[model samples]
Target: MQLTRFTDIGLRIVMRLAVAGEQPSDTTPMTTKDLARELAVPYTHVAKVVGRLAEMGAVHSRRGRAGGLAITDLGREAQIGWLARTLEGPGEVVDCEGSQPCPLRSACRLRGALARAQRAFFDSLDEHTVADLVRDPTGAVLLSLSPPPPAPPTDDAPGNRHLPQHR
Candidate 1:
């Protein structure tokens, strides 16, 4: 079963956060803008997914200068299947109840088979966690995408003009 774009983005976000969480120095929370830029996804889309992740207790968000987004421990340890299911919601792979309802809705073996296939897909995912998705090379790549922390002001910097000079 193909994963929806929404679930795909959500998974990417979680994986990136999990990678960051593994690196103490990289634990600085990332803003939605940063995540969007890094993932090459639209800001609005990332924002929406971030909101849902926060609701799931998989992501933590804080507002203000020092506030940003971070993956919670729950997010890092969450089973991939459970997270995917949460992101995917309760929609069938094949829409039997659309405006033009399927004529075979009442007697469709296909629907049952598709449902079983979907379950198998998720069950396979259950074997992994966000951390599992970012081991070694993958984790390194995701960590490389993180924005560097702001540089501290030096004595000669414009913002440090108020500081007393030490010869």
Candidate 2:
């Protein structure tokens, strides 16, 4: 269930930008060389993935004296969604509702367990915007990239009543 290098590198590039936020005028637009230097990835590899992300509207690239890359809102959102899906094992899980039944269907608990866990994972992610991811890229640096935590229930009353349940 490992993420493809393409997705992995693209996510790294986005994280770098997210962490960088608004680029400093002194900091020239990041070239593939700059990304390579900072992230330790080869320029060629990063370029392809980065280009793909741009094609997908996940990034915006400019050409000229200050030509470089920056994150777009769409790119940021796509990156966050991409990371969430990858961490949850992406294509490795089957939705079991109508697919071919596995031989272990009668005994395998992993499927149901993972399905419940995946739903919860996505539910938690739905609470976050890409801005959150940009702010906390380091939160995942040396640790596992788990799903975002479920947001604490909001207090809506003087007695500290929880917010209304979401459907």
Candidate 3:
């Protein structure tokens, strides 16, 4: 699975705000600077992302000292839903080329099995809400401090393709 850094960061920001809850504490508002510091991301990068998020109405921002960032209801739901789709990739997996179908199409049990696994992957992700990520802010913070998850196995992995034996 290929998750764009944008969606990953977007979800992190949303999760943080959800953990922080609805009130931004006296309207002093949490600035991107504060968020960048907490998230260990560069200030300018977070600012740019925050701009896009604000435009999408996933985050609300104000200008000036008291102005800061907070999550809107729409932003939370939309961001989560968007992540569910894009996190997997911008494309579909089961594609057939030309008029030729895979010879295994008729007898391959693994085809449907893999499809079920793929569906489970998405369904599992969709079950989560931003609220779930915030259930334990400290734990979430600890987890994010670690590196990103390992990349999924590629076609280069062993046994990825069936091969014929040499004569």
Candidate 4:
């Protein structure tokens, strides 16, 4: 199923934040312009989606040079299917619109079948989270944003298990 622009951008926003979280030292939250550029979308579009996400408590936003967005803990842990449901609205997939009410409206099997298909689609997506999306090793989006692997442990390092007793 094709997602609406709003839902698509919302998903992108979450994934972007997920990628940001993957950064070991990249503490600066992304500005709307930066996110827009990264996603190849208009700045205004990102702002609008950011507003919606902020209102939902999925993101935290502030205004100013130091202000930007960071995904909320709730957002980081959000399930893909749940986010889609919120963005898409919990509405019936097929409307019974016609020039006049169709005679089969009441006993329509198509509606039931369509509903089942929708459920199955979402069920599959439920198996994934925003975390899983960015964890796709084959994709460079998150990889490009990630920091270098941390150095290996050393005996003299803080919290090193092999440190000699000095007491």
| Candidate number of the best lDDT | 1
lDDT of 4 by residue, 53-163 (tens): 898888899999888889888887888888887888876677766577667888999888888888887778888888778776724554464334558878777798766
| Per-model C-alpha RMSD | 9.4, 17.6, 14.9, 15.6
lDDT winner, 2 or 4: 4
Better of 1 and 2 by TM-score: 1
Candidate 3 clashes between residue pairs 3 or more apart in a chain or in different chains: 58-75
What's each prediction's TM-score?
Answer: 0.82, 0.54, 0.56, 0.75
Candidate 2 lowest-lDDT run of ten: 139-148
* Candidate 1 lDDT (Cα, 0 to 1): 0.90
lDDT of 2 by residue, 35-118 (tens): 766776778988887777777776788878878888787766653655556433444356554567677777889887876876
Looking at model 4, residue 51 earns an lDDT score of 91
lDDT of 1 by residue, 54-136 (tens): 99999999999999988899999999999999999998889999999999999999999999999999999999999888888
RMSD of 2: 17.6
Looking at model 4, report the run of 10 residues with the lowest lDDT sum: 138-147
The lDDT values for all models are 0.90, 0.64, 0.66, 0.79
lDDT of 1 at 17: 80
